[model samples]
Target: MIGTALRGIFTLPDLRKRVLITFALLAVSRIGFWITVPGVNYDVIEEIAGRQAGTWIDFIGIVTGGRLTNASIFSLGVMPYISASIIFTMLVKLVPSLERLQKEGPQGYRKIQQYERYATVLICIIQSSFIVAWMTSVTAGNERLVPNATFSFRLMAIVSMTAGTVFLMWLGEQITEFGIGNGISLLIMNGIVARMPGKFSMFISNIARAVRQGVNPAKEVTELAIFVLLFVGIVAFVVLITQGQRRIPVQQQKQTRGRRVYGGMRYYLPLRVNQGGVMPIIFAQAILMLPIAIISSIPGLQSIRFWFNYGTFWYIFAYVLLILFFEYFWTALVFNPIEMANQLQEHGNFIPGIRPGRRTAEMLEYILNRVALAGGTFVAFIAIVPQIVSSLMGYDIFLATILGGTGILIVVGVALEFVQRVEAQLLAREYEGFMRKPMRGR
Candidate 1:
């Protein structure tokens, strides 16, 4: 099946070009991982990174595909650009001028993107400054991460990190323009996948250790098989949720023209079940990091932190609640039922049974809330699968996360989207789709 898919994908000249360009750009993105920023003590950074194991450092490393511990040029990754984009997305809705500009079509949209680029620069500078400050204060025993905390050193480090992120942003834009899938999403997916070799190595090492200790190799093999099946099932479920949506039937009002009647066509508006995508999970994780960091720093909080440890009951409970909350929150920010209703009415379109204006807005809002609840619950469950699997099955958290949670979610989501794009291209060019074999004609 996979071989057929690849053959079909590469057979198309345009798609093949896109696929190659995407891969070439992705390869370029990884080169920054080896190029560390200046003024950083490699030895101390490694030690500090070792100590920070299993913390948010690992989480960020896996999610963003960037290394912060090493003070690398690409330490900021595509996140700053993504953050700026999100900020502008909300601003377009909140600010009337931006909203109007967005409604103006391509030229106005380009202006908004220009604004987002400027915002990305600002975000990079702020984040880079923080990284520089963090490097100077963090230590491995007596050795500081930034041994020389001079103004020149700080300036150099900040500029290097910022430049790296800007480069990534440009690279992502190029990929989107010429490649098969979304450029930014592809970058993130590539980063998460880069962690795979290390995970497989760890898994193999564990098996080797068990064999050395005289444990049955058959038992290890069975466990591995079970893990693979469960991961496949989880991926299927995620795909189901990601692709699920409710289509509301819309009727276009008829228009009278002298002797002819026009319009009165019907269509559907699709409202996705998992409207939040991975943002809710990202928001939950970002907020959850604070508790993890504060627990060890503040005296007497250590005991309480035990209950809040990853995979604990309280941790899962809190994590689920946050995911649900942020799911609705993000959905609300991105979706405006009132605006949608207004646009529909202005265009002489209305839901089949629902009246236009206030009633339509109310109906849409109600449906959105119900859909969001189901989606949020599902997202929360998927997000915590790694913790549950690790805690209950005694599996490694880092390795399990690859099989579940944000890593798997992002990878699966990107793959599905990429496949859809390729299929669209193939269909347009009158060729067989990836999953479907060419039909036999008698």
Candidate 2:
């Protein structure tokens, strides 16, 4: 199946070109990850990162595929840009003036994008402060990571990292223009996947060692087989949740022109079951980290950090609540039932039995609530279940997430989206898509 898909992709010239461009851009970004920030001792940076293992720094590195510990040029990754975009996206939806601008189509979108870029630079500088403080901090024995407390060193670190992030932003835009799937998402997935191979290799070696140590090899093999199957099942479940949607049927009223009849038509407005995508989990995790980071930093509050440990009851419970809250919060911002109803009414469309105005808005909002509940619940489950299992297995939370939890979920979602896009391009050209079976009969 995989080989056939490759063949299908290579069979088309345009798609092959896009795929190559995407890979090239992704490679360029990865290369930047190794370019250490100027005037910082890479070894000392590593030492500091080592001391802070299992903290937010490590988590960010895993999520973004950036070498923060190395004080690399791309240490900030695309996160600053992503943060800026999310801020601007929510503002665009919430602020009436921005909303009006957004409704103006392509030109408006371009204008908004320019605003996001400006915001990205601001966010990059703001975020770089924390990283710089961490990088320049003097350790217990007088060891210094930056060694230079001078203003030039600090200034360069900030400028270099900010530029790296902006370059990534531009690279992502280029990929989107001349490549497949979404450029930013593809970059995130690339980062996540880049960190996976080493982890997976380690996992396999551990499994093999355990099998060798076992008195019953066959039994161990069976258990490993079951674990593999369960992993596949979970991935499939995520795919279903990612792609699931609640489609509302709409009917358009018939209209007649002077010499022609037009209008009466039926279609469905599809709302994704998981409308929030990874944002809720991302937000919940990030928000929870703040208090944990602060408490851990305090001299006598280290004990309190234990409660916030991954897979603990309070942590999981709070995590679930945050995920649910952010999902609804995001849904409310993105799904405006009143606006939807107005659009439908303008187009002479109605949701069948539902009236065209306030009633339709009411119906849509009600349905959206139900959909969000189902989606949020599923998303929380998908997120928490892996952490619970990883904790039970006594694995490091950092390694576990990179191996399975939110990390794998993001990879699966992005891969599925990318495949769908490629398939769309293929089908549009009267060619077999990725899933199209090869003919075997003579």
Candidate 3:
């Protein structure tokens, strides 16, 4: 099945071209990963990053495809754009003027996009400035990452990093216009995947060290097996939840013209179980990082940082609540029951045993709230399980994270989306899809 899918993908000229363009653009993004910001000693930065493993920098590395560790020009990655979009999304829901603009259709959408771009630039500047300050301040063994903590160095770093992000944003747009899949998501997923081989090597070394120390190699092997099983089990569960949906049947009104019936048909609307998808997790993670950042910056607050530590009980509790909150918050903003009801009425279609206008809208809202709750609970569980495992098993947080947390979800989600996209293209060309065969066995 996999070989046939690959053959089908390469055989189609348009699809192949799009795929190639996507790879080329992603390669360009990766180039920035190796190009560090000037005036910084990367060796010192790398050592500090190693000592502070599993901190915010590592988390940033995970998000940006491992560029933060090197303090590269593209260290900011596509996060600023994502943050801007999320902010605008919230504003559109809260501000009546933006809401009105949103209802104006394509022209309104374009306007909103322009606003988002402006917001992205602003965010990039602010974040890059903070990074400059942090890098200049951090030192290791009398050696500083930024040797010269001058205003000129700060200015140069800010402009270079921000430009790198803007270029990445443009590259993502190009991929969206001329390539395949979502460009921003593809970049993130690419970064996460690029780190996998190194992570796998670390996993092996961890096991080998335990055995060499006579710390019961059999127990270590059992743990490895458990991790594998847990990873696979979680991935399977995520895929099921991600793809799960409820199909609401609708009946179209029949019309007669010259004794020929037209329009009478039954179709179903698919309401995804996980409506917010991965955004809720992203929002929750961003909000949860605030406490650590605050504690680290303040002198007296260092003692209380453990309360907000990643594996602490209070931290997990707060993280889960935040995830649940954002799940519902995002769902409410994007899914409009009233709008859907109106569209159904205009099309002369109605759900069976339900009225067309207000009642149908109410029903949809009720269903959405219930499904959103389930999704929120599932994601929250997935997010924290790895932390709990790491705390209990005394394993590295990075390893546990890749095997269990948002990283796997994003990776699996992107892979599924890419496959579905290729299958769609194949079907559009009247070719057998990845899972569909031309002939059936009797």
Each model's lDDT = 0.86, 0.81, 0.84
lDDT by residue (1-442, candidate 3, tens digit) is 6677788789999999999999999998898888989999977976886776777777776765646767889898888998898889889988999999999999999899999999999999999998898898888998988998899999999999999899998998998889988888888888889887876677678779987887867776777788778778888899999899978899999999998999979999988887887787777777878767676679987756677777887888888999899889888888899999999999999998999999999999998899999988988888887787787877678788876667777888888898888788877776667777753331
Give the candidate number with the greatest lDDT: 1
TM-score rank, highest first? 3, 1, 2
RMSD, model 1, all Cα superposed? 3.0
Arranged by lDDT with the best first, the candidates are 1, 3, 2
Error of 1 at 230 (Å): 1.8
Assess the local accuracy of residue 134 in candidate 3 as a C-alpha lDDT between 0 and 100.
Answer: 86
> Candidate 1, residues 1-442: lDDT per residue as tens digits?
5576577678878889998999999999999977988777888876876676667777877677777876899998888888888889889978999999998999999999999999999999998898788788897777788888999998998899999999999999999999988999999998888878876677577689889999877877778788879878998988998999988899999999999999999999999999988888888888877767777678877777787777788888988999999989999998999989999999999998788999999999999999999999999888888888888898877678866777788898999999889877776766677777654341
Best candidate, TM-score: 3
Whole-model lDDT, model 1: 0.86
The model with the greater lDDT, 1 or 2, is 1
Model 3, C-alpha of 155: deviation from truth (Å) = 0.6
Cα deviation at 279, candidate 2, in Å, is 0.9
Model 1, residue 35: C-alpha shift (Å): 1.1
The superposed Cα distance between candidate 1 and the true structure at residue 135, in angstroms, equals 2.9
**Model 3 — which ten-residue stretch has the worst lDDT?**
433-442
TM-score of each: 0.90, 0.89, 0.92
